[model samples]
Target: MGGNEQKFIKEAFDTNWVAPMGTNVDLFEMDLKTYLSNNVHVTALSSGTAAIHLGLILLGIKAGDEVICQSLTFTATANPILYLKAIPVFIDSEIETWNLCPIALEEAIIDRIKLGNKPKAIITVHLYGNPYKIEEIRAVADKYQIPILEDAAEALGSSYKGQKCGVFGDLCVLSFNGNKIITTSGGGALVSHSQNIKSRAIFLATQSKDKAIHYEHSEVGYNYRLSNISASIGRGQMEKLDEFVNLRRKMQNFYKQLFENVKGVSVFEVPNEDYFSNHWLSVITINPSETNGIDCDDLRLALESENIESRFLWKPLHMQPLHKDFPYYGGNIAESLFAKGLCLPSGSNTTEEEKARIQNVIKCLFKNKIKKKIKVKSLFPKRQRLFEDNMLVNFFTKNRLETS
Candidate 1:
């Protein structure tokens, strides 16, 4: 944690304004507006998920409605639909960006419309701080007259075509969870172009109360307002937001440089110059054939053996048992990505010694795989080795795995 975080919290206490609304919350909201400038109004909330739920409600989503959601993202992006009793029609990701597939999204829209259930909104995500196909997805949403609620939970500093991601959606959400680009400890904000929408969101977030001297509740409300204490942390985080984004990018570049010559791995990259991501988590796909049958799981195990924390990418939500019956479009792009992809440690505070250890483990894993394949090929032609290796035939059977 940065030193200034305590300063803001102190201010909150000093001023005796420690409720959900206070000086800190106002400062936090202003900071967001200044950073995300695009005629956007910001409302600090309890969580990014709460922001999405409220955004959908402001967009007229009600019980039993349908919202098309990207199937490859975290469940937080889709769970809010259930909060409103809205059926989340999942959409698949394209191979290029591992984001919402425009074609599949369009097909889903057409079919749903045919069934007389035109989706109330399209919930797209910029996964892992990578910008999705904004133009393509926006085109489909516009064509179908479906508003978009961009889940920029992992993409606070990411942009597409020079426009910040959160501003592209009719209503966008930003997360300040502990691990996010910025930490409010745990908080989020809703951004929108319309002031009315922002006002409505803030009103609903603080509990929908009628403007009366007495306690009068006109509509159902939620306690989704960001606490003053949390907003204090957000205000401090905003001070170093750009630094955090730059650090994240540097980490991604470091990974890209380290893997540039490696045969088995291709670090995930920005699709083009039009996209500028925070590179929240530097990830790569390990091709088994290129790496002598070494896969993502193998690398993960190696890292674990060293007590280093590396993880596989998220399994697409569509394939999850909870949403198993949900209709999903697109081929196996998301599934294939999940199988081969792994997210390396991309924390801003990662040390050089830690990096060296991580890289050494990966390098050794690949080198061993290459050498074993070569020895097997020499022992019994490529075809014979392929069959024999499956049966645990050692490259140096006589030498034996048990050495003196």
Candidate 2:
């Protein structure tokens, strides 16, 4: 938590504006607009999944319409398609970005068109906060005349060729969940190019209530507006967005240095300087053939034994039993990566002591023969400590995470 969240929350209570659509929400949206540095509109919502659902609806998605989605991502990306009763055509990932493969994406669109039901939109993601091939993906989507619904859920600070990720899609989504680079306890936002679209989304989020003396609904809507308290937390978190991004990137550099000399270990990173990643999670792939057959699971188990948390990358949606029957495109690139991938300890708030413990576990697992010694560096070396107290978070937790 940032130091200012409590101050904002306190103001909310003092003003008795603890409900949704308060001053905090307004200012938080402005903060996002300024940071995004684009002429776009943002409406805070309940979660990224909600943002996706609303985005699909606004994009004219309907029952039986096909929507192309990245295969190797959180289920939230695809579940929304099912919510709208639309068919999801899964596309595999490219090695350069671990995101939607443009070739496979185009193939899916062409084949789906040949099958007589053209996809409504293309869902692109920046997996692990690394920006995908934005230009490439956009080109393919344009060629096929499909709108892009960019899931920048894990990429709040990411960019491609100097433009922000959220602004690239016709409709985009950003997540501020508890485990994101920054959090509002739990929330998300939908980004659009026009105020009219933003207004439409706001209306839908507020139960499609018409401007009547009393609540009146004419269309299907959701109770997904973010509460003033959550927005207050977000206002504080926005103040620390750049700080959190730098800290997350610092964690990525930490992993890069740790595995620089490890023959079988490869840290996941952006393909080029044109792509900037927040590196929300530092991930690596293990080639068992190079380290005397040490696989990803072997290293994961080692970390587990020491109680240093680690886990495999997301299993492709196409491989999940729940989604196995969906039409999938492309080769086994995503599958291969999953077999070798593992997410390391990459929390921004991790202490020096905790990092030392994690480093010891990894070094010991590799037989302590690593040439370079891992450093227990401070995440904030020259600034005042940001986290002043756990009082606010503790209080919120005690209150069952507070109301919407």
All candidates: TM-score: 0.91, 0.90
- Please estimate how well model 1 matches the true structure, expressed as its whole-model Cα lDDT: 0.84
Residue by residue across 1-404, what tens digits does model 1's lDDT show?
A: 65699999999999898899998998899899888889799999999989998989989999989999998888899888888888889887888788999999999999998999989999988989999999899899999899999899999989888777799899999999988988998889999997888889888998898899998998999999999999998888888888999999999998888888888799998788999999988999977788767667556656776778887677678777778777777777777777678899999888889989988877776765553211111222222232223222454335222111
| Candidate 2 lDDT by residue in tens digits, 338-389 | 7778899888898888888888777776764332222322212111111122
The TM-score, computed over Cα atoms with residue i paired to residue i, of candidate 2 is 0.90
Q: Which regions of candidate 1 fall more than 4 Å away from where they truly are? A: 370-404
**Which of the numbered candidates is closest to the native, going by highest lDDT?**
2
Please give me the total number of clashing residue pairs in predicted model 2.
0
The local lDDT score (0 to 100) that residue 366 gets in candidate 1 is 70
